[model samples]
Target: MAGPNSDPIVSATTAAQLPPGAVVLHVEAGDRQSAEAAFAAGHVEGAVLLVRDEVVTRPMRPGDGRHPLPSAEDLADALGRLGVGWDAPVVAYDRQHGDNAAHVVHLLRLLGQDARLLDGGLAAFTDPVATGPGTTPTAVAREPRPWPADMLPDIDAVAAHAAAGGVLIDARAAERFRGETEPLDPIAGHIPGAVNAFYGDNLTPDGTFRDPEELRARFAALGAGPDAVVYCGSGVTACHDLLAIERAGLGRARLYVGSWSQWCRDASRPRATGPA
Candidate 1:
């Protein structure tokens, strides 16, 4: 197993002050409550909290593509406004278990940013269970020219990969993968022939990703290797699994941008329900 193109997790304090050539991003992920807490308490300097709606290129295009990969220009614009450039180290965080940060990571990498998540996210900082409203951070990101990224794979690309016999792993939670819920997408069930590998399974007790060897064993059990393609409900948390797999040095994993959200929208696409 080899690590991802970059580290899976990094610290805020050190990452913030890294040399100019290095790109580190501080991304905050969470619902409003946690975001408010981290903001009120001050997050990593120069960090940006991605609002799900604002982050994506086309905010809502159901079934069109689950987590439709943003265009380079749009993504670069978003990152540029946040003072991010292709050369910066990106460190991401969330108030809780870094739920949203997972998507943030996948998207950033897709856009060609050398991004990494903050271990334990904002929670890992003080490991805060409660945070008073923080005064907004002073570190405002200075806009930089957008850098080109090539990490994300579109639905057609994924379909082609599947047709070519590449492994397609579903990283949704067990129930969701089994078509037990349809909270975000119009349809339930998963892409036919995809394997189930829950993103939550990648975590250790502290919410940080598990060790490398542990991940290798777990993924290997599923017949998945470094060459696997992973997807989740909307290409969000599935990146968490990809992060873990890469962190554990499993190998590079591609993201199916449309994921279940995209998969469900197309009735012609085969879907499977029940245990994997």
Candidate 2:
């Protein structure tokens, strides 16, 4: 999965202090009322609540999985509407254990934008919370480029990786990875030769990401390196693991964007049950 070497993207370790002029993006996939209720209770100062329907995903198709990515143009439009400039340093947060926020951070990074998930999410906020609606920035119309080609691996690439004995990680729950329980997708197993590294393991009990050295040790157990490929049920939660990998300084890993949902759709693709 290792490709071109690029400059590092700076991140904020805490919610209280961010890169200057950083925009706080609060992404929650729950119902609007509850999300707004949570936002009113206290969101980072000057943070905006990005509506779930508006930016979370696009219409689902048979092979696109439950949470298909929106078009780059549509995403650019949404961000522009929210006043997120192409160069703006963004700190995204969500109450759902950083899954939603990680998704946004992943996409923004894919688009070559400076974005990072607030470590520990909203709970990590040590500053005063602001109530009511979010502040709108002076709209900036910037034409966004297409999604980076190297950001993800397609189905064929994933199969090749597995066949080549490349490191492939399943970020689903251990039970789900073992085919013991699958409450979402129809499939109950993981890709052949894929190791299970439950994304939640990257976080501490309080929900903040574990220390980088600890994370490095955990991924090292799975043989994670620059060539690793990570996936989850439908590719949303997988970003959390990818972010963890980056935070651990483990190098860039490719994402199987369609993930298990897309893989299982084609019965010809090999699927393995139980522990790898």
**Candidate maximizing lDDT:** 2
Query: On residues 48-85, what C-alpha lDDT tens digit does candidate 2 reach at each position?
Result: 88876577578778777667777888877878888888
- Looking at model 1, report the run of 10 residues with the lowest lDDT sum: 127-136
TM-score of each: 0.79, 0.90
In Å, residue 109's CA in model 2 sits off its true spot by 1.5
Residue 232, candidate 1: C-alpha displacement in angstroms: 0.6
lDDT by residue (tens digit), candidate 1, 42-86: 555444545554555455564466446565566556666655655
Task: Record all residue pairs in model 2 with backbone atoms less than 3 Å apart, i.e. clashing.
Answer: none
Residue 123 of candidate 2: its Cα lDDT? 70
Backbone clash tally (model 1): 19
The TM-score obtained by model 1 is 0.79
| lDDT agreement with native, every candidate | 0.64, 0.79
